[model samples]
Target: MIAKLLSATALACLATISSTASAQSGSGQKAPTANPAQPQSQPNPPSSKPEQQPTSKQPTADRSKLIEEAVTAVRETRNAVRAIDQNKPADAISALERATGKLEIVLARTPDLALAPIDDAVITYDVIGTVQDVERIRAAAKAAFDRGRMQEARRLMDGLASETVLSVTNMPLGTYPAALKEAAALLHQGKPQDAKRVLETALNTFVVTRTIMPLPLARAQSAIEEGRTLMEKSNRTDAESVRLGSLLARARDQLRLGQALGYATEKEMSDLVRAVEDMERRTSGKQQARGMVEPTRPMFDAANKASQPPKSN
Candidate 1:
């Protein structure tokens, strides 16, 4: 048999978001480093075409961490790939057997599973700035996207959002087990070339999904809380009132940023902004601002809550 080279491209580590710091420099704030992959929403990875980039990219450190709790089938798949790379057919067959055995255990528990989850990690990216900054970046990103400059578009929009993104990878239960079994049989038939191709196909059948939590909305809520704390104080000093005004402005700014980033509907953000600015106007004269930020809380709360975490099958 002719020695065939197996093509297995493991996911490359997500590129670090270096430009966000420069983007946020105007606000003197660093975008959340909690490790978000991209500021944009992404679809699940396609089981048929694994060559395309995933909607969510994991930071290198987080990828290393996810490997710590590796699922048995996934790890075995990696082992099988490695064995193929080293031209060790026997080892590859052994790894596939172990993988199938694990799947048997899993399928026995959940027979109707569609896609079995392998692992997930949270990736966060935050771009902290006032409304003007968001507008500037949004325009640039739109132009870049229109020009079909995806990398440029992604970079420009990266700092326009403040979000916590969760990326998950799963194996398609419908076909993966069969592929493993077929690869094993191919090996037994003394066709390592064919077996290697089957294994590669199996690896690419994994799908990925991303869930996003808006950090800007949360920041707005935080600002409102801080302002409310001051309002709760009796005999508030003029300086405190001025500080309250600043906080209200920050809250309004965050709301506007959130709106630009499409975290909330225009109407929803508009209503909140109108209310916040109205309160802000009252606080302008250094007078005690009277209002409960609690009413405004529900909208932000609802938006954040809507971004449910990824569920493993």
Candidate 2:
């Protein structure tokens, strides 16, 4: 009976070992199946990468189109001014309106276009011809100003000033006198601030110095006088008055510019003094002439009678 029991125990142990091995094999197979599902979870294919989207590039071509539009608008405006000079008022007005509209579009699209080239072209083309195209721009600005279009007037004046400066840039020193004359008009029109700014900018050119012996000093004095006159005529609260203050500040700036350019020489200073004296003499002469024109016969007779009677008494 004991041997039979032992044999039975050994058979049971063998059965248990077989069952454990089968369980181990089943688990190993499930692991591979789990790995297959993991690949499904990684649904993103190599073809579906984030970089596959189209890249947004710079709109260089678009910018070029805007610049072309701006250039065309400037040219059209210039042509319109020429028509105005030929006494074609209607045609000129119509063309100018169209040009203004085109420029508006360009400005709306791209406001920061470098206008130096356009400005240069406008002045060069107008000043050399009988067109007086630049004058038309000034007229437009004046009309705008009269109509309470302050911003519009400012824009037009700025454009005009820029163009004038550009035209004189390449000219010899002799051209500054004429340029200053043009600038003076702008100043007289209550745009003294603009005049000062333009003169300051034009003085940057070496040609201006090459032509005038004491170029920097002369410019500084002129700027200072312009500022002083404008300030005297201005009301402190008005925009134009404020601009006059700016002109005065710019005059001081021109003095500094003269110093920087080495144009502040003894001769220049002497010339400045002489100019001041001449101006004073002219002013005094005019005052004297006005006094002489006064109607003072009655007062003179009264004074003469009083003196004669006092002597007789």
Candidate 3:
């Protein structure tokens, strides 16, 4: 009876162990392999998210430095186009594309860069005689596209776009003196209303013309034109005339400041100073100067011509 009990207990314990192993295996968990040469499988590493790299971004002040670099690159590309070897059109196109890339980086960030001054004057690309080169490259690019040279065509297109933008952005400054001269001529002819309109328009617009105007001279010209406009408008009523006198006084003050800064000629300084004083007297309900318009015309002509900077060779 004791032997029979020990056998039954051993059988029950073995059955429980078998049942547990079978359940674990049925649940998709592999039991350890009994073969000595086989190794156990490892579960996949905890599925971690990817690590991102840091970006290299610079400060805002260095943006101007980048603009200068882009300008230099554009200049180089323009120069390269002048001597492009026909057999190696790819080489010239590549250089131009690189320059375009540099420009694009800046343009994307600052579209108003056209209005930004590089060195006291608007940043000028001044691509000397590049229009013909651009046309030639465009023709080549079209031909390449026709021949299924897609890469070359794409490069040429990029270069053309960049060159076109640079050329457009290099617009010359307005001839403020010329406009002032026109205003003076009108005033001399007793057309003060027309003269005033001209002066006001010039002050309000980016008047692009074929004249080289220095920045300081341009500012001085605006002040003088404004003063002259105010003086002309003063002829209506006593209140209006008094207002004009006060404004002209301030305008004369600005001209004096410009003169001290060497922006105006000595002759201009004297003439405008005298004109403002005469305007003050006339507008103050006192004796008006005789032949005011005719006397001031020559002074304006001299000042206008003096304000014009010599054209670049």
Question: lDDT per model, in order?
Answer: 0.61, 0.33, 0.40
In model 2, the worst 10-residue window by lDDT is 19-28
Q: Every model's Cα RMSD, please?
A: 11.7, 44.3, 41.2
- Give per-residue CA lDDT, model 3, range 1-313, as digits (tens): 0011112222222222221111100011222121111111212111110111111122334544543544454454443343242333344445445655655565566544443122211121111113344445657778999999998887755422110000012211224334545654564565655655665564454422222222223333344455454455534566655555656666565455434333338878677677867666775663333444456545544554554434343
lDDT of 3 at 196: 55
Rank by lDDT, highest first. 1, 3, 2
lDDT, candidate 2, 47-147, per-residue tens: 10111111111154543454344445445544544554465545544554564565566546644332211211101100111113444555777899999
Q: Which candidate leads in lDDT?
A: 1
TM accuracy, model 2: 0.21
Per-residue CA lDDT of model 1 for 122-203, tens digit only, reads 4445565545556667777789899999898887665555565544566777888899999999889988889889989888
RMSD of 3: 41.2
TM-score of each: 0.61, 0.21, 0.30
Alpha carbon deviation, residue 39, candidate 3 (Å): 76
Pairs with backbone N, CA or C atoms under 3 Å apart (clashes), candidate 1: 35-124, 36-123, 36-124
Backbone clashes for every candidate come to 3, 0, 0
lDDT of 2: 0.33
